[model samples]
Target chain A: MSASEIPVPQDPADALAAVVALRRLADQLEDAAVEQAMRAGWSWPQVAEALGVTRQAVHRKHAKRLIAAGVKLRRRSP
Target chain B: MSPIDAYLHTVIMEAATEARRQGSATIEAQHLLLAVAAQEGTAPQRVLASAGLDYQAVLAALDREFDHSLSAVGVSRAAFNLPRPSMPSKRPPDIGATGKLALERAFASAPRKKDLRPAHVLLGILQAEVGTVPRALALAGVDRADLLNRVRDAIAGDGVE
Candidate 1:
């Protein structure tokens, strides 16, 4: 269904569930996008810039996760 | 060859060879996907092709992703070409954790031990919570849920060859 087609949650419980599900989907999207960028050989700074976050912020958030996931991350000379 | 053994000999070995060609030590999900896309007349290959993740498209997507990432870091393809040294194939390359999990999941999703098929592996890869398969599919603009539903329909509607 289109975003416009999605009915707004009327009940508090429904709203809460919507929020949780949205968060999970958002997490998956971010993770997938980041992993794609990394696999493409983008540096942390580049990813940070693309995401409009500081290099440190992006790196802090994703460095360990990418490493643990076995993504071949490389540090480019800035 | 038995279905399972044939799959292992062909698909798995092709992925391993791709990894070796790329100078990677471990066979990854992306390589496996590439292998699936390369094969003809298979359920997984058909699904991937229908989703626009066919062999050449996937290769281009991977290259584009890498180039895009590098460009973000102020690098460009025009700047330099990195040589990919082929690793010596002393033995078959080992499957990485992600690839292993995908295989395990594929087996688990199979209806019967003797009936393992590429569609199950495709479903497994789609359902993979972590790994290059999901990430690459997302980058390719595929709807994972839709792909999963179609695969299910294919399995139920017609038995995979």
Candidate 2:
């Protein structure tokens, strides 16, 4: 979508609230997307690169939750 | 522990659970408000219910607020067809900034620590003029000022008992 086409809330409160809601949506999306990628046999490095974050950062964030979810994760990439 | 201390602990614990259920990384003011509304037979709960804000109502209002806020940016949550993510196995979410602010306001509302009651916590949450709780209350067609007055009255009546 073009910058001009993007909707911006007129009210400052509404705009701020949209930021909060978008952050929450992003977090939820990341969790779901990471899990889906891992379950599909994607390596940690691959997922990290895809997310434009460090492997350690991604692992620290999601490894435990993914493990508990019983999605067998691949070993660390060489 | 003092009665108020114990009550605050239970409410915080319930709020943590609410945070976890909502997949939030921290327990926010909204979660604390939900905890207050869910607590059975409390003066605060009664006060909230009087304004048609039971626990379920609060949850519904918050959900509506989330959707409404997203729509403001031209995004629809229904477009995301992914299944809900698994619950995080980490420790219960700690109290976030908004939650701490509410508690601070609650503590400050009383004349002294000894005067503090459960209703004071609700007062603190209601005192916030912005953020998720206030926005949700507004969108739900509830008069926040009226609710705040009711909570204050409840606290005052409890003091006389």
Candidate 3:
């Protein structure tokens, strides 16, 4: 949807809460998307680049969880 | 450790578990509230139950609040068809800002640390006026003021014992 088409909450409390909920939803989506990409053989650099972040940053954030989940991660870029 | 300290630690640990179960990275006030509701035989738990806010009911209320908040921005969580993400099990979630605030309020509710009780924690959470807990309770048709009074009464009754 266009920015102009986005709906705004009438109440400030509702608006603030929407921001919190949206951030949480975004975080959950990122975790699921990153896991899905890694499981599908995407490298750390590739996922990081797609997410507009540094490879080291992404790796630090998700490597342990992904490893624990047993996703076969690519060690390095080809 | 004192009994109150032990109890708070147990509650925080349980809140961390609840946070992880919901894929959260930090234990917030709502998680603490859920932990309080789940702790059977506690005055806080009894008070919550008397308000129709057992663990499951609280969970439902929280879920409804999430949906309602998202709807405020015209977004529907149902529109997303992604599977539930796997929980990160490497480390337990640390307490977040709201959780810390609730604990602080709980501690402040009693005149002294030696007077701390589980019901004080519930009072702390109930005292938040502009957060997920209040919003969820309101959406669930709960009277926040009445609940606060009930929690206060519970705490008072505990002091007599």
Candidate 4:
């Protein structure tokens, strides 16, 4: 998006908290989406298309699945 | 406690105490960053020290930051535009009359006037002799001259101002 496309924004402190929250949410969503996509036998390209992005972009963002597969980041408390 | 907030507070307090130690009359952003570097105990300190930005050098930089910020502002120090994340000051910002009065007496040992401007007296506290501020700045790879330059540019620079 263009720079002007961005809104002038909210109170910075409030905006910062919201940004942090949203970032946490984005991570959870991306993680779940990728895991489920992989489980459904979708290739990176297929998942990338479904998410409306290039395969390389999607892979680069999440390919570093560094854990031993048992650990996961916790979601925000409901 | 929220994990991040707790982490941030530890950072804030460390910066504040360092500011006090450096005898930096004010809690400027350089001190805060220096404090963060100090708390991180990151490799940056060693790197900076090798670059000639030892603790004393960094504090000297921060002092300059404070001075430049004062006049670089279109108005005055009171009318400065601080970067938002750079708030809550490393030190308690009770810059009112009582604070000023206390400062005068604190500096009574000097050969100066009875009244001191905010910069004049605050410098008194954060100088190399007292606070760990200089040390903290050095840890951040900055010295007094650089800190002063940052403060100057921050206040007088283009769009951000």
- DockQ per candidate: 0.02, 0.86, 0.79, 0.01
Of models 2 and 3, which has the larger DockQ?
2
Best candidate, lDDT: 2
> Could you tell which candidate, 1 or 3, scores higher by DockQ?
3
lDDT of 3 by residue, B85-138 (tens): 677765988889999999999999898878889899999999999989999999
Alpha carbon lDDT of residue A9, candidate 2? 94
Compared with the true structure, the alpha-carbon lDDT of candidate 4 equals: 0.43
Minimum summed lDDT over a 10-residue window in model 1 chain B is located at B80-89
Candidate 2: which docking quality band? high
| DockQ computed for model 2 against the true two-chain complex using alpha carbons | 0.86
Docking class of 3: medium
Give the CA lDDT, 0 to 100, for residue B147 in model 3.
93
- By the TM-score metric, which is better: model 1 or model 3? 3
Q: What is the lDDT of residue B26 in candidate 1?
A: 76
Stretches of model 4 off by over 4 angstroms after superposition: A1-11, A66-78, B1-161
lDDT of 4 by residue, B35-138 (tens): 43453333334334445655565566655544332222221334433321111123343232323342343355234442222222223323332123443444
Cand. 3: chain B TM-score:
0.96
Give the runs in model 2 whose Cα sits over 4 Å from its true position: none
In order, the TM-score of chain B in each prediction is: 0.83, 0.97, 0.96, 0.32
lDDT of each: 0.68, 0.93, 0.91, 0.43
After TM-score superposition, what is the CA distance of residue A29 in candidate 3 from its true location, in Å?
0.5
